[model samples]
Target: MGESLSQRLQHPRRSLGDRHRSQAEKFLRLSNQGEGEFSVNIQWAEQNARQALLHDFTHPENWRMLAKIKVLLADDIGIRALLSDLFAVLGRDPEYVSQLEDVSLLDVGSELLNAALQNDHLDSDIWIQSFDASDVDSFVERFLKLDLSDPRCNVLFGRRLERLWDIAGSDVCIHLGKVLLSHRPQNYEMWTNLGRAHERMGDYDQAWLCYDQAQSYAGHLTVRDDFKERMESHFDGNSSVAWSRPEISVRKDFLVTMEKLSTRFSDSVIDTGASNEEVHVDQSGDERRLENMLKNGDFSSAFFLSRRLVTSGEMWAKEYLEASKLALEGKDDVIIP
Candidate 1:
């Protein structure tokens, strides 16, 4: 079996990161010494710096080293993107965002990073790195206290969860993905990524649903069709067996379960003890809520509520669900769900 989540969380491979950082610094020094081709040494340095980050993203030094290398290579855009990623990891503080206004990242990337590090060093990635399993409740408490409403922050968390999936399991990835999607349902790429995670975990039914959502959001995308093809390929040459989408009821159940799991960690969810299914409102109120979600371009939430109402035998909800699907497909003039 793979290492447990607690064990992996407790050890962020700092030693490996240090080793790679050392190697990167050595290569950088060699490049300056002119012992060999400067480009070759810089290439080696870049490789090691990247490995260092892959091993331990929490280390601010690792990020700085990579940013320095990008500067040496005159990759201004790369440096900017790196800084953006760091800001995302830092929860996209307004101050940090403002510091970049009318500024050239190529010249001030390092200084900006330093300022960010000084302003607030309480990075969730760093917390994950230094996590102590002795107090599991404390760890959970700290995690729950994070602001998860930021899309970039959620993306950063989703990427970290993906990297740790082998040790932490696919459920974590699924939960994080749902949380991110709930905030930005228009991110079809993330939907595809979530589908891939589900596919890896053998949750084909859930995978199909995710892919379906992705395709619905981007009509030209073929991820859902590609998934179906892959499924069919597995049963080729078998006349009796075939792959198919789950029944509407099964899909609805899965969505509800996923929504509950996501809301468990999401700060946006209401504090009420009632689950979505348990929250009973008059039919008019439900319709108004659905309409408001559609007006706000919250297609994912609108889709879920419409589907739930349709499953409960509300014919009006069928129209809303179809409208939601159309809006998700990029139809601008569709009625609000």
Candidate 2:
């Protein structure tokens, strides 16, 4: 209880309303600041902004801020103009801000005070609008699936994706990408996308960090090497298997020597930044290997496999149950080489 979970969930208990409105405007500012200009989808701009901002953070207080903003701009030709003004201030301003304190939250208020900056701001010329309400709604429905944890994964989309790295400077997309990496450390796709973005930025070391962090497994040293080898082999070629060249193989005994390796991570190579759940759910075991074992009726092999899992005390894996049952049945396929 280093921080009270309740305090971690700090919401104002007092009402300082515009008679009692409190300074809730501050929360909106920080949320948008964290996101670096909430880019709206012109036609479905209102819907997109509402959901994106709402889903971006899981905190209840953040959602309350979104609800309040929706109430504030519920009317209008559309919230597009007002939203644009908010984003204009949101642009170039977050960069200078330090420590994410509370006053800059007021910058958003400066615009809320102005009614006519609405005309000064323009809709993205490139965003097409549609007359059908459902079309906009449907587009937003798909966007709802977009994982906000990784900005680069989604921002580097369409042709805009290709030109993202070519922009005037680190635009909203890049800024959000960094925030995502720093904040959502447990998200692999977040790390993967950041690595991809770093590749675009030509910071190979940083990019490699992203890749290495994503690629690491957390178990035995020998098995980790085998996993790494398998991962490297995946990059062998666009024309073949790997993308790199070897006049010949490096660990001359790579084949025979590396056979004594564990396929799953233990603890040491485990990257805290990656999700532990992802390691087991989607590691690099070839489907062909599992399928062949089943096809060859390698029941003892499957039994021993399941035995390790059961003894590992992971309780939830049904694979462990099946293995125990197979061992009870005395299958003969397993004879470790």
lDDT of 1 by residue, 56-90 (tens): 66677888898889889888767777777676556
> Where is model 1 more than 4 Å wrong at Cα?
1-89, 92-145, 258-285, 292-300, 307-337
User: lDDT tens digits, residues 1-337, model 2?
Assistant: 2422112112122222121122344444544565444433121333433443323222223333433465444433223333332332223122222323343333343344233223212122232221233444443343333332222222222222223333423444444444333222223344455556766676544555455434431111133234345546655563455433222122111211111121121111222113322223222242333334444544323332333333344444345346433432332121110
**Weakest ten-residue segment in model 1 by summed lDDT:** 328-337
Give RMSD (Å) of candidate 1 vs. truth: 12.0
Give the alpha-carbon lDDT of every model. 0.66, 0.33
Kindly provide the TM-score of model 2 when superposed on the true structure, using C-alpha atoms: 0.23
Query: Model 2, residue 155: what's the lDDT?
Result: 25
For model 2, what is the error of residue 324's alpha carbon versus the real structure, in angstroms, after optimal superposition?
A: 38
User: Number of clashes in model 1?
Assistant: 0
